[model samples]
Target: MTAMNTFENKRFLARIRGGDFAHPGEEEAIDLVLSHVKPQPRETVLDAGCGLGATADAIGKKTGAVVVGVDLDAESVRHANATYRDFQFIPGDVTKLGELALPKMDVIYAFNSLYACPDLDACFASFNEVANPGARIGVFDYIAYDAGALAATGCLPPSVHSMTQMRQLPERQGWACTGIVNLDLAYAAWYARFLARMDENREMLAAVRSPEVFEAVRKRYADMLHCLEQGTLGGALHLYARA
Candidate 1:
């Protein structure tokens, strides 16, 4: 990835941690991920891009599994480590998982992480490095392109893979889709909450985002709200894939 891309990932991670779009309730998406992964006491798990270590903490505490979360942002790593004592949070690049000194994991959760990875092949292969045979890989994220407004976010370029393309690409990387769940209601609820948050902190939001960028984001949100109200766009997809 380019340096600019790496920087963009960091900015995106910050937005996630700030609860602008990634609210506390986004844990519901993670809940869907954990539901498919029945962890054993001795199992090791990895939560890639684990902002604030919320999912990692839940999984680690619940299953008594050794969970290690990785993220490219030092702030996120620091935040996660400072907040969650039981789960380990490492500052590392998801694109280079082999260099992270992580153990083989029985399961890897990539909730909202794959979208930031430009090289799908390399990103998926990185998961293979830390995954044991037959390991479960669960991901909960927005299926873009189909979500008209959601796709127009400035954080994401328009050239990336659509939701269908993302789903198909995993199979090519040696993963088999075990299950899929529709997350329209959750996404709609989150979007509503996000807009309200923006309203509550409009000045702060405007200070960080330029006028043009803010307008673009607003347009994207408007398109999403319209599609959401009309029930045309696909909301979100929770995938359980096995490596």
Candidate 2:
């Protein structure tokens, strides 16, 4: 367990998160994304950058939609398919989704995912290729308040756009901006709770993850919490529709 592995990050978070998702706000975040997307039973939902397929599984079970998940991580894709047998998990890049040749997606959502993607135009274009006309896309991830500050922490994923940059992306990519929810305060509170929980469960966490992993996580969370409190890091949910 001390060795570096593909699922180590996931395993570390799973121990702390107490849920299937690898994001802040955990189930609450999924509820927020679902409240807006509202995928019906008959609709085909695509989790564009699903990590380990938990969110997609939750989406399927909650909405009864046909869920298909895609991620660039082969290990996660395999784990997702094996763990959640009902859904299809494909190993593919969100920025090059057209090559996967997936069915026309009725709705696409990226929960705490997408911030790692440096290019949204290509990502959106690839999404357009597989998404049906009028398909909805929801992105719930980090918004760059200070890309440099956030990147230095190494706790969360890399984000390179501000709220203004994010807002302009949809129309530039031929989609309409439907809604935006600023989650700065929510994320700050979440990180505070996260750090507290980590401290409370230090002994148990040490047993679950190796010493190296434990220290790595502890340092990252501390730095992340500092950034969040300083208003140098933020989060948001951006919704869009094909036009």
Off by over 4 Å in 1: 1-24, 147-155, 197-235, 238-243
Error of 1 at 162 (Å): 2.2
Output the TM-score of candidate 1: 0.75
lDDT of 1 by residue, 89-170 (tens): 9998887999989999888877666666767677677888888986887766655645445444343444344667667777
In angstroms, the error of model 2 at 183 is 1.0
**TM-scores vs. true structure, each candidate:** 0.75, 0.92
Measured by TM-score, how close is model 2 to the native structure?
Answer: 0.92
Using lDDT as the measure, the top candidate is 2
Off by over 4 Å in 2: 1-6, 152-158
For every candidate, C-alpha RMSD to the true structure in Å: 4.6, 2.4
lDDT of 2: 0.82
